[model samples]
Target chain A: MCEILRLAFAAVFVLVVIITIPTKSMGADKEYGQYLSAECNACHAPSKKSGAGIPSLNGKPVPYLVSALLQYKNKSRKNAVMQMIAGRLDSEQINALAAYFSSLGK
Target chain B: MKKISRRQFTNAAALGLGALAIPNIAVGAKPKVVVVGGGAGGATAARYVAKDSKGAVDVTLIEASKRYYTCFYSNLYLGGLRNYGSIGHNYYGLAVNNGVNVVHDWAASVDAQNKRVKLASGSSVSYDRLILSPGIDFKYDSVPGYSAEVQSKMPHAWKSGTQTQLLKRQVLNMRKGGNFVIVPPTNPYRCPPGPYERVSMVAHLLKANNPKAKIIILDPKPKFSKQGLFMDGWERHYPGMIDWVDPGAHGGIKNVDGNKMEIKTDLDTFKADAASVIPAQKAGAIALAAGVNDGDWCPVNPNSMASKADSNIYVLGDASVAKSMPKSGFSANSQAKVAANAVRGELTGSKVFPARYSNTCWSLIATDDGIKVGASYKAGEKKIDVVSKFISKKGESAETRKTTYEESIDWYNGMTADMFS
Candidate 1:
């Protein structure tokens, strides 16, 4: 009986792990996106004019944002500063940032 | 990681409030955050805390000035590259748009015990968390024969505003072919590259207006930031127009007299038509009054920029000892975001993400000639460590340099917007 109860407790713990992991990541995505966008916001102003040296990211398609950052990271994009900034971002950061930026001005 | 339940937050906060013993007022009333100084750090922190909290936090910013002139780009004004009014900014966006209570008054002192800030207006504003980002204060006596009294005659122009205008007028209207001497400050000051950049801009102005005028640098240090890059640009653009005498070369600065406009050094006593005598520096007075300083600067936690002396207070910008990061406007703005996030989380129980910081300083040598150095930082247990870095090469193409110069203008617009908007 003791052995059986221990096995049941192990099963319940595994279930909790499965339930919690995605939720935690999902909840943190928006907040993390907001926090990390500050890095971009330092140079890419939300109030950027049309002729601004740096291009605006507001209202850009999420896929385009992700693609542009990835290109910069992959050395396909031209600007050295942008490349340096984009190089550090991981896939998770790129996706989340794209989502957050795309959500802006909506 | 386990999700933070309400009871879990309570227990964790109880253990965390070692110094303040602040109760769990997160439930009853919105948390209050008071930020002092309105330059790069303070304004950014105030706006972030207020905007991010979404009306959950009461944020008040205390600044003495009606208009803020950025020290970052003041050199451009001296160079005739930008208008004086172009560099100045106001707080309308932070107050009207972001819901920040902007109080135009001097922050006389900080009451850490009560978490209150005493203003020069005889009013005390209290806070759950107080951010002090009062930049730097000049140690006037650090330079022999230089004091606040003589500052009018030989203006430092280190802190932007009327002093900048005074220095500009002095430079522009000086006698033809006159000597323009600049005494760069010692180490660990704001913008490690500032004095050299100023020299470059001043040289740019003199090259156009008074081509025969001589510019001398009596540097306290044996070396300076971007020495190679600056020297190269100076030679290419203003050849034979600028000379830099290091401490070893000049022996040392013996005395300076504003009335006679002379700098007496061990090597020689040189008469100057105009001069900028930048003095030694310390954390601003309010930080000292707040008892947050260890010696000359407040030591802050690497992860949060919270004062090591007081958990409830965070020190930002040049006033704090941010190891490995130069004291710069960009550095201050970076630190402010981290502090804002941490403060908001402490009050609202919001998820506190890890802190990341980056800074880039751009300097223009002559028309279309620019150079940059930058690094990104991450918080470690003991200190903030550089993760990645880059600098402009010595022999970059003209196209690259022009692009860099233009990029700097855009960055200025973006940085100001980030702070104010």
Candidate 2:
């Protein structure tokens, strides 16, 4: 009976681990994205009204942001500053930033 | 490949559960943060602490003036590009939206040992951490024969507001073909490109209205920031209208007779219809009272912006001795975020990230001609060191310059909103 009880406990613990790992990783990525967003906020605003001549990045679609960043990194975008900034970001960081900005409300 | 067995999975899960159950000891009471000087640094720090902490930290901001006129764009105001109302900002949004306690009063002194501040209103406010961003104060008598009494005649206009308007009025009132003299401050001053931008704007005004009016820059420094770009634009747009005299050529300034509107240099005396005399600067007085200063400026840890003298005290913006960062509003705003994060982490047990900073200074030369210089920085062993830098090219097309000018306007709007709203 003790052997059976130990097996059940192990199965439940394994199930919890399987559930928690991916969620925790996702949460950490979002947090890191928030940190990186601090720099972007210096130019691309998060608030409504979009500032004068600057676009609002809040609530942008993840796919759209990803594509735009990739284009900037590939030198398709004309802005030298944007190209430089985008070139520094890797794919994982790009996805994280997109997710973070997309999660915000306009 | 070896696979994780059920026993290993269970052990890891149990450890994770134990870690989750451990309570955070720093979560006992709300921590209080007091910030002095509600300019770019103080305002951004106050807003971020109040907003991000989500009621975990109480923030109080003390500013002497109710309305803050930004020193960044005051030159544009003088050039008639922006209005007085546009450059001015108030603390109302910070109080109502961000939940910051905005106290419109003078912060007289800092009691560092006790971590309390004494206000001019005779009240004392205590804090768990203090942030001082008191900006810069002019070194009195740095310029010979120049004092507060002579400001009305040769306005510095460095601090913005009424002084800006006064300088603009004096420029407008000058006779046609008259000379306007600008004595830019020595090195390690606020806004390295500022005097040159003012010269550009003044020339812009003269080129249109007072076509024959000439601008004479008596620069103490041999070479100024963005010298190449500024000289290129000046020659292109306002030829024969601007003459820059370096200290070598002018033999340095000797004295100024404000009564006669004349400047006496070792080489020759120059009489002007309008003049701007910017003096050398030091850290604001409160930093010294707080005992956070090395000499003229406060020394802070580059990573966290915490005072090297006292860990609980943080200094940001122009008053802090940031080694590689130019003293500008954008640099102050960037430093504030790094400091804010460190403060929040200490008080609220939030995760602290490595510090990263960036600054871009944009200057409008003509109506549509703009140039910029900027860099990204990371905290190094001893100071914030530059990582990457860029400057506008000398021979950019008109369309590119206009776009750059537009971008600066956007940045102004975005940065202000980020600080206030």
Output DockQ, candidate 2. Answer: 0.52
lDDT (Cα, 0-100) at A35 in candidate 2: 67
Candidate 2: what lDDT?
0.87
- lDDT string for model 1 (B111-161, tens) is 788889999999999998999999999999888999998889888999999
Candidates' RMSD to native: 4.9, 5.0
Q: Which clashing pairs does model 2 show?
A: none
- Model 1 pairs in collision: none
- Residue lDDT tens for model 2, A1-106: 9999999999999999998798455542676578678778877766645334557889999889999999988989777667766776767678878888999999
The lDDT for every candidate, in the order shown, is 0.89, 0.87
- Tens digit of per-residue lDDT, candidate 2, span B1-421: 1113522543454455334323433455567899999999999999988988888788999999999999988999988899999999999999999999999998999888888999999998999889999999988588999998899999999898899999999999999999999999998899999999999999888887899999999988899999999999999999999999999999999998889999999889999999999999988889988989998999899988999999989999999999899999999999999988888777765656678888889999999898888888889999999887788998899999998988888888888887888
Which residue runs does candidate 1 get wrong by more than 4 Å?
A1-28, A50-52, B1-27
